[model samples]
Target: MEVDDEIGSVESKVDGVGDRLCSVFSRSHWDSIKDSPHELWIVFVLKLLSSYSYFSFALVLTLFLSTEFQMSDVEAGWVYGLYGVFSTVFGVLCGWVVDWLGVKWSLFFGAILGTIARLLLCFCTAPRSAVIVLVTALPFAESLGIPVMTIAIKRYTHTSNRTFAFALYYSCMNIAALVAGPAVDASRALFSDGVTLPLTSIRLSALRVVLFTSAVSTFITVLVVFMGLREIEVNEDGEIMPYHPPSRQVGAWKATVRVLKEKSFWRLVLFTLLLMGVGLVFRHMDSTLPKFMLREFGGSDDAEGVPFGMVYAINPAMIIVLVPLVGMVLTRVDSYTMIVRGSFVAAASPFWVALGAHYWAVCMFVVTLSLGEAVYSPRVYDYTMQLAGRGSEGVYTSLASAPLFAVKLLTGGMSGWLLERFCPEHPPPERNAAALWSIVGATSMLSPILMVILQPVLHPKQSPNIIPPVLNSMHHLEDDNASEGHNSESSNTGESDAEYQTGFGNLERLRRQHSSSNSSSSSSS
Candidate 1:
């Protein structure tokens, strides 16, 4: 009743905020979005601009390393892999920065670093220099950028409206990706033979042109953060207000340690790690597909035939059209179930590529993959928010990115080997492209299969025997409290029992109480 009343109060506040914001979204979503603060819109623009810049350069990062540095597919893959590995590591290490500095300053810091990295790319001619730039500043910039953006989405909207808020956030990213496709192809086509500046003998490649453009977009992002955004938080009454962490806040390291000690954190870690298999397919799209399209189809980067950017653009294009629809339709589905269903669909996409080396096959792969992604990816962010404790969203969300680190580690060297063996720079008549994709397809099947097998364990309320001994002890403690008359009349034992179940947020709260009690006992002793 209290929850319902809170949601109702939130809705009443939203109803008076303003008129419908965007007609493109369905009527089902308008109630949720109409009340969104102007700051949320600023975040939308920032995400669009920053994402467009990042993806435009990322879409060709592997190609640039291979061509400009005169590195083989294997060497470039290792370098690209290192970039992904370190970037994710930096993200994990520095996610607390967002929690410490708030969204506004974090955006400024990350965007400036990104701008500096992109500018360096335009002039750096040596492989070692490129490697240093990619693994250091670029990683830190990317690491800080995403978690804070998502945290902004969480804060700038009402709790009841967070589903649509995250969906819109996902759509903004895809929309930017969609725009980057043409920008990439156009930049390459216009600067086909490369261009030399009047005063200097240095010539700029198509890749460098894209990087330079991306750099300018990143600079604009910094300006948006400076001029258009202010740090804000949703208050206890569910109203938007200026940002402040709690007065008794611990340092970032202590906070992280407390989070680590929670059983829920381990559960989140296991869930994300299980997700690494399907995650690899997304990584492969960037790492492997460009080379596949170019080599298998015999097309030059500047040529009209088989534009990789356009082909890559197809996924995000479909996502932009499908996300809102999926959200409206699947509003009642549980997050874990959605993940299972979506993983099944995504896992099958690579098998389409296994069918042949044809353009139609790759297109089918992307279309199917996008369909599954549209169903599940936004929910992943939403689900993480559910798991996070108050003031800890940034760290929890960053830890949720743990799967990508594994995926990157696997895809880098694996993609290079797959390409060399089957879809090499020069393909022979007997090249077995089918075998390569077949391996990818088969490996991706692991995630869904394992998820299905582990269902009983993941949702412990359904099968109590599968609960670990630690959970059993926790349950015993609750039982003792109830027996000792510590239970309140309003206590919901079923809800309490399901703390170890998936998709509940208060597990963190419960663990904290348990920890505080233990600490108090120790101090008394």
Candidate 2:
């Protein structure tokens, strides 16, 4: 009875301490959150929905171009590459527009454009031209979604929790990608079998139905944004205050120039460039892989064996499991180290695809690739924002899209040329498959080497002593309290008044010097 009572008392004390700790931590986090301007929960949901439309289209398009159009590895590569190229170009322009016109118009326009692009794709018949035009438009339309969403996130969240916000954002993107694969497959199977559509005799291809469905989804997303998303004004404290209806503005060129001048901005640009190059290879794989399987692994008849589209699903499927694990690793490790290691994984992806003969091997290769992406993708964005600092979120995010565009241009041309060069005059399926995998593998390997060099340039080290002005204010309060105590003691003891005044003056001067130094360093570095 005595032992039981003692145990209960100890448990009660532990519970009390735990409760107090929880309250303190929760209050601190809440206070930090309250200081932020925008509502993160609402924005997170909107971004998830917006990403779904884009990912759905990409997944369906990859299978469509590879199977129905019979595009070779390089040919399919160009199709996907064009998407990045156009998106990157428009993303830069969109950044300027978002900074000037605000998030509302940017999102509105993006949705409208994305809807139109999908609609245009549904009408396309000629494979090459259709692929080119669709690729070109898809990026521009989708480009608006990320930069504006990022800006909205930055406007609302404090620096401490910004990484968490980006992680959530990226996870949403992967979720969309995960959903898109199976959804596209199901949608294709439905329409191609004449089960869902009105027409009985004419069974539309899966690609056509998927494209139409994606277009409708895009339109729906546009409607939602128009109805639900409101633009918030940023206050002097750098908090997003309240929603105000947007006003038309000319251009964000001046703001663009200011952002370009920052050292941190350039670092983000380099890092994203390297990261995007690594990611672009995978994007190309979505288009190229199905065709490679069909050509190399004997996936001719739909009823005879596993569908090539199903194989493409492996990466996203693995991502659902791997990302949280990667997140755990990120908690203990610096992002740059993860990125470097992830780059090697990315580099190895094309080789696995090239070497693998069986469906299972291809699936395994995809799993490896996805694992790397699961780590690298979220970290890249998180690191970029960390480097960007307070008000320059939009600019940094937009600039990050630039290298992707450059890669697209180079890859698009290279892909087309490689296909034409290796498999000239309607080459056999075996030769086409081999050539495609070889090119992809070579590029994938090259990407990591580039990233290794670029990583250090983009994320330079900063001194720990430099604190932001907001933090400095809190330090001043602590100093004031210390000084009060010292003066009270001096009064009691009748200490020298001149010495006390000198000490206070010196402390103030040191604080001012530190503040000035930080400002200069921030501007210069």
Candidate 3:
């Protein structure tokens, strides 16, 4: 009878211990997630407004150069190409500046510059000189926008949640791209119809009206950043703390160089260069495809013939549908794999473009290109963070934008020259198709090739000190406290059960003793 009673007691104790452990584990897991710092909804709003304004400007700018300025495909290409080059150069500088000045200031400066550039476009009459100045100023001014926004999101978000944050960011950009198409198209149609002002004496071209609208949009973005956004502060001990002014003066150049020295950083830079090179092939599709359709596809050059404006609509539309889905998938898949797959799809876009016999075929190719973008776009920043490791998120994020700068410098002038040379003044269908295919095919292939080579280099290695020493010290202190608690519990457990029971009176009293012992054990454990 005594043996059976003791067995029952043992069983009850085991159950009790198991229940306690399970409760502890559940609490720990919940705490971990709850403590993670990601304001997903707020980040989403910022991304939406920023992307909307930026892409809206791009859509208007493209349409204005093509229609109002009466620029040829080659001339329009050069003008836009120059804008890209300037933006690229300014982007490199802005990446460093974002780290030094803080994201808010960087964003504010970029927005102001962008607004001014757009407003200037409204008043300028000489297309050549105006195009040159706007091209130069707009990109440089806009350079700060993306890098600053990226840094802000990174600083505020947690590692596990960052991929989703970026995905949301990319989605907003695509959404903007989608909205810009109809907006620009409508503006053009309205302006062409000569809609008179309600009270003003000024006559306006559709292009002027669009430029003014773009400037206003930029100003609104500036207001949002300044008024709606809050700065995130990092503690000197290298932990995320409440927003406070930084005391230590860190030079942007030093931070940039430190980032450059990391092997992973270069690997990511190479990957971005490849990705941008590939994406640039598609960027040109908006400017080049319309002209190709007009000259070679037997489309009328009149508003109806390969309406270039219509092609712009396809990418944005596809992006709106695809981006959210891609964001959810990013949580499960390896980002590098997504990038590789996207590159392969992009490389194949030219073949699709070449295969297009009808306008629908052209539209299909554009759709394919946008699909590739949907997959690739979200992963770019996620990969940059991985490459950044710990202290260099700002630098890596900025570097991701570098490819846009580099590709434009290397290919912009050449693309313009090539179109002028190979695409005839009045291109036949065959010649136009060939030129478009060649450009897309060559540029698209480069991204995949570079990505394959860089992938091995980009793989994450064990980082020795991603978290700062001070943060690590605090973690060790907590661990020590926990360890001491566990040690005390174990020491108490060594005491006789009879002695505990004799002193405590009942099972409930024994449980209180056990709980105290266990609390100490937990500290050690």
Full-model lDDT for every candidate? 0.72, 0.58, 0.58
Model 2, global lDDT = 0.58
Per-residue lDDT of candidate 1, residues 310-369 (tens digit): 988999999998877665444333456567778888988999988998989999999999
> lDDT by residue for model 2 over 48-106, one digit each (tens)?
67767766666555446655677754566566666767777877766655665567777
Off by over 4 Å in 1: 1-28, 197-202, 236-238, 246-248, 299-304, 400-407, 428-430, 461-525
Q: Clash totals for all models, in order? A: 0, 2, 11
For all predicted structures, in order, the TM-scores are 0.81, 0.71, 0.72
Candidate 2: lDDT of 303?
30
For residues 380-474, write the lDDT of model 3, one tens digit per residue: 66556544544455566666556666467545555555555655445342355555676677777877766665554554321122211333433
Best candidate, TM-score-wise?
1
Worst lDDT run of 10 residues, candidate 2, spans 496-505
**Where does candidate 2 stray beyond 4 Å?**
1-39, 62-77, 126-137, 193-203, 233-240, 243-251, 299-305, 389-391, 413-429, 432-439, 454-456, 462-525
In model 1, the clashing pairs are none
Q: Which stretches of candidate 3 lie over 4 Å from their true place?
A: 1-43, 60-63, 66-71, 196-198, 233-240, 243-248, 294-307, 326-331, 389-392, 399-406, 418-431, 460-525
